[model samples]
Target chain A: MNVFVVGVGLIGGSFALDLKELNSNVIIHGIDINESHLQEAMELGVIDQKSSYENLSLADVVVISIPVNAANEVVPRVLDAVHEDAVVIDTGSTKAPLCELLVNHPKRRNFLAAHPIAGTEFSGPSAAHVGLYAGKTNIICEVEKTAFKLQERALKIFSDIGMRIRYMDPKSHDRHIAYVSHLSHISSFMLGKTVIEKERNERDIFDMAGSGFESTVRLAKSSPAMWTPIFQQNKENVLETLDEYISNLLLFKSYLEKDDFQAIFSAMESTNKIKEILNGIVVKPI
Target chain B: MNVFVVGVGLIGGSFALDLKELNSNVIIHGIDINESHLQEAMELGVIDQKSSYENLSLADVVVISIPVNAANEVVPRVLDAVHEDAVVIDTGSTKAPLCELLVNHPKRRNFLAAHPIAGTEFSGPSAAHVGLYAGKTNIICEVEKTAFKLQERALKIFSDIGMRIRYMDPKSHDRHIAYVSHLSHISSFMLGKTVIEKERNERDIFDMAGSGFESTVRLAKSSPAMWTPIFQQNKENVLETLDEYISNLLLFKSYLEKDDFQAIFSAMESTNKIKEILNGIVVKPI
Candidate 1:
């Protein structure tokens, strides 16, 4: 099987590597506008060949693994070039906008919209690894819209990469991911900003940042280029989630200011239930 | 040397274990208000003997490792009972209030107000482990108030346990800790609260939580009893930090709502500097 992957950065690069590792017969071609990333992907042996979009017509599979904004434009273009039998898939973070944009495409039946609930704060081709998708959930939106054979092909590929599949509407995917994924990125970035702005002393931040701070702020290191469009595409939902998040913080702060020890204690006590929720998720490093 | 540890939970239990691991001649006496924790501490052999308040005077050191509110009351009382040659220390998160309460104590010279920046999210004797303080910073505040001999004794113990020491005033310690530690707890607790309230389904939370959410929200599992007083005691600093944090989030939310991709992108781009600061701290599992 021949797979042509556009935007060979973290997710794309990892998918390329995993495909090669699992199926020796699979030949992977890398494509990226970032020349250095393409070179890095090839040099790192993430892909079998470096190719351009002009040759995407020959691919058995076409994966759009770019930023959400780029995916919005590029996925349709790739579909226009690929053969009728070729399967199309995307690993974009926000689903609704992309799904809405591609809803009426002539080859929409060949495209599968997916979000693998897996990632690290790190980016770039070098950050990619072979087992990135293993034991993680992959949400497929508008699955019924895709032709059965193409959907099966995508599912088989995901299964080979060791992912559990769950189906949902694009709208629902966007809403849930706002809370689960998007809100976390904003929370972490703002936390990093808060500490950096308030604690001007770099030495103090270094000396005092325990593992809790490290974990809490780790996502602040994510690529702004990749995330900017995700936040933009899922803007409304992300904003609502952020409002609720800020409100929660303000309420807790008031409890602290008023010396309402009982309220503060009970609030923290209630959140401890997250332990059980966390224990059930599969956590892996990037 | 004999060490009597009041409240042999996470912090105190670990200290006892480390002392025994380093010195065979060291005898540890365990004390806790919770009978189960005391029994578990004894079963784990964290101490040589389980003792009551009457035993406080027999020790060469009396370490108060209770909740912040309890430490304020208990440390003063423990100091009254300990031997003249003994060194007393408290490992509560907040120091300003405790230091103020004990500032004019007749035996203040025997009390070294120290805050060891070592802990996990989980609490109780079951969570204790050896070497929890290894290479971690131990902040000693108001050291000048401690008797020279007592300070010397405490430094030797900390050194033997493999800790790096830093000194600061209790007021400075509380302020910095509010940003680095207390605010993290509040952010995490609220992250958990907001997600739980929005999702309304624990199963969805378990399915969707990635490592980013888990890491950022890990501190939400911390013992409320341990954190409530820290917030109450350092209310001013916590409130200010919380206000700034909420403002940052709200600004980012507005950018998202307006689809201001550039503003959101730049905001996250700037906050990514936390990567460099967090590089200095060691992250240990709780």
Candidate 2:
């Protein structure tokens, strides 16, 4: 099978690595606007050949793993270029806009919208590695819109890469992901911003950052080029989550202001239930 | 050396383990209000014997690793019970109030106010480990107030456990910790609270919590009993940090509201500097 991967960065490069490991017969062709990333992916053997959208017709599968803003413009173009029998899948963080753009297209049945819920704080082809998607959750949105055979192929590929599939509407996927994933990145970035702004001495922060601070602020290291588009594309849901998060912070601040130790304790204690839920997210060791 | 450790929970129990490893000739005596913890500490060999305040005078060194609220009351009593040569070190998170309480005591020279910037989200004796303090930072506040011999003894013990010591005044310790440590806990707890409140289905949260979410909210699982007192004692500094943090959140929200992608990108880009600083915190493998 020939796989044409658009935007061959972290997600696409990782998928390429895992796909080849699953089936040696699989040949991955890379396409990216960035010439260096395409060269790196080829040098790293993430792809067997470099190809353009004009040659996408040769692919048995086309995976779009670009930034959401670029994905909105490119998904239709990829569908237009792929063969009728080829299955096109997108691995974008936000799904609603991409799904809406292709909902009524003639070749819509060939495209599947997927959000593979996995990644590291780092980005680019260099950060890509096999097993990134292993034992992770993948959300398939608007699955009913895809043809049966294409959906089956998508599921089989995900399973081969060790991902468990969950089905939901694109809107639902965006809404929930805003709270679970997107908001975390924003909060973490702002945390780093706040600390850096307030604590001028970088050495002091370095000296005092325990595992807790390191863990809490890890997401701040994420690529701005990749994330800015995500926040922009998922603006409404992200804003809603931010409002709730900000309000919670303010309420917590008020408790501190009133010296309401009991309220503060109760809030944290209630959130401790997250441990039980988090323990269930079994990430395969890298 | 006779070492007496009060409140044999995570910090105290781990200290006992590391202290024993560093000096096999040292004897650790455990005391706790909870009988179960006392018994468990002895059974785990975190302590060689059980002792009360009545026998504290026999201790050449006393380590008080209790919650900050309790330390306010118990630190003075521990000082009163110890001999002139004995050094009493309280490993509380906050330092200002505790230092104030012992400022004019006749045995002030015998007490050293220290905050070992080390801990995990989990608590209790079972969480204790031998290398918990290895490659960690220990902040000794008001070092000038401690007698020369006692200060040297405290530094030697911290160094033996593989911690680098930094000296700061009590007020500076409290202020800096509010930004670097306490603020992180609040942000993480509130993030957990916000998500749990919005995402009603526990299964959805469990399914979607990737490494990013897990890392960002890890501190939400910390012991409420332990953290509440620290926040209360450092109310002024914590409140000030919270205000600055909230204002930063609001500013970021404004950028999101206006669809200012450049501003959002730049904000996160600037905070990416934290990655460089965080890389310097070398956590030892236990």
Highest lDDT model number: 2
C-alpha lDDT values of all predictions: 0.86, 0.90
State the lDDT of candidate 2 residue by residue for B1-286, as single tens digits.
9999998988999999999988889999999988898999989888999999999989999999988999999999999999999999999999999999888998999999998888889888888888889889988988999999999998888888889888888998898889889999999999999999987655665587788999999999999999999999999899898888889889988999998999999999999988888888858742
Report the error of model 2 at residue B33, Å: 1.5
lDDT of 1 at B98: 92
* Model 1 / residue B56 / CA error / Å: 1.3
Worst 10 residues of 1 chain B by lDDT: B277-286
Model 2, retained fraction of real contacts? 0.87
C-alpha lDDT of residue B106 in model 2: 88
- In model 1, which regions exceed 4 Å deviation? A284-286, B283-286
The weakest ten consecutive residues by lDDT in model 1 chain A span A277-286
lDDT of 1 at B205: 46
Over 4 Å off in model 2, which ranges?
A284-286, B201-203, B284-286
**What DockQ values do the models have?**
0.76, 0.83
Q: TM-score of model 1 relative to the true fold? A: 0.97
Per-model i-RMS? 1.3, 0.9
